[model samples]
Target: MTQPDLSVLDDHFSAMTWGWVGDRGTWTTDAARASLDALEQLGCSWIVLAYATLQATPQSTRIDYAAAPTLTDDEVRWGIRESRRRGWKICLKPVVNVANGTWRGFIGFFDQDVPGEPTWAEWFASYTDYIVHHARIAEEEGVELFVIGCEMVMTDGREAEWRALIERVREVYSGLVTYNCDKYQEDRLTWWDAVDVISASGYYPTGEWPRQLDRIEPVVRRHGKPFLFIEAGCPSRDTSPQRPNDWTLEGAPSGQAQADYLDEMFTACAARDWVGGFALWDWPAALYNPADAAANTDYCMYAKPGEAIVRDYYASRRSG
Candidate 1:
């Protein structure tokens, strides 16, 4: 999991994230480019360009990354090229998803081999190919940081496979590498030494920020590696701050609710030096109309008051 030092990625990664831009040709469009430009103006020092590649089920051994649902490799490269050109570090994170409408965290197999049943060995082989494919692109495009996997909870216990996958990635990507474990998993993983940095989804509920950081900080210190939240944000929905990880929660859209969450999040995190900055959940490939910001309930911060909260927080990090 070790690789060449990429000092360029050492700064507080004030990353504004764009995740799961699933459409095939979306990144090549002017709208996508304008979106990236807008993200840069938020005082962001890093950009997280994430996409999802699909498999048929959680137990499916085959990962079909080149399927029509994912962005083309050329689109990924353009994103990396455009982000670096703007003087922003790019974290190219490609995630695995289940096409059967299940969460990726549930992807798993039997602990012991069962004849005719899918095996972890089979899954890791395909998954490794999927990651190595993107790792090569990250290397070619000079991406500052690359996330090898995201929120694969059931697979976290397979330490050896993860180490091997990260080792393969290290051979291709010369820059920093990290694996994005699910929220609350910072202390659960035993293989932090397998990657250059430690990262996880930071989706703790409201009022629990300090407690969770207290829990996660020791893990980072114990491993002696840098840490960051590869994914974190609240939806405009009123219920979001209480369960920032639940996008499906029902509530009226309120930008102030989102801003309040970010305010508390940044204030709490600001006190902890080891808690590196975030890559917010998303800013869409095709932005919504600005006037409709209050009505939009999903996590995209475009034109929302929360965007201002992020801008001010990131700006303070630069000037302070």
Candidate 2:
């Protein structure tokens, strides 16, 4: 395999997560190529190839793909190769989700051993295997960055276990590494010094960008590590800006609302010199009807007004 060049890391990253599942062909198809082309036109300098693992609960000591569809290992390698071939840097983010529909943020274990209840040691043992498997792949594929986990809020308190997991990851992967902490949890991480960068989900309300940035600044300053939003976006629905993190919020479709939210987020972060960049929440593995874009109320920016806002902002950064 040809090693991907990491020189692009010095630039501000305008990225999108190509969230996909099912099979190897999904990434190698013509639609995938077209999606990558669209992303390039949107001025994306980086692409996050996100995959998922499954566990029955936070305490379950097994991480496997039997419960849900996931991209095959071969498909992920092809994705990295294809994205780099298009001149985009790559961040391999292997996330975990519970099989019972619980959010990963709720994954947790008792601090002390409890009989009949799974132990933190057991859970971390399985999680380590899940993460290290991808880390080795990231290293072999020359992925420019590796994100160990995403929004595992309850487990963040177990700093020792996470740090140990990071140590294990470093043994196999040689690249910048970071964890995607949930929004508002950034300052709580005392172990930021262990990773190459500090990252969090940037799903702040449209009106609260400045205040949230104020709260986050001290953490970034104290750690002296570069910071960026690993996941952030609002749905194209009425009132979505006020509750940008809630994907299930109900309302009529409102493209302008989503566009305005993106504009506000980009403007605020652009003013903060310490903020590095962002990888928008997602773009889909399969696109929907272009004609129905107005009726679509998801976070996807495809053929929507928010897409142009993101493109213009990212293009300006590249040009400036």
The global C-alpha lDDT for each of the candidates, from Candidate 1 onward, is: 0.88, 0.85
Error of 1 at 98 (Å): 0.6
Best by TM-score: 1
Estimate the lDDT of model 1: 0.88
The TM-score between candidate 2 and the true structure equals 0.94
RMSD of each: 1.3, 2.6
lDDT by residue (tens digit), candidate 2, 286-319: 6777899999999988899999999898888788
Candidate 2 lDDT score relative to the true structure: 0.85
lDDT of 1 by residue, 270-291 (tens): 9999877788888888888889
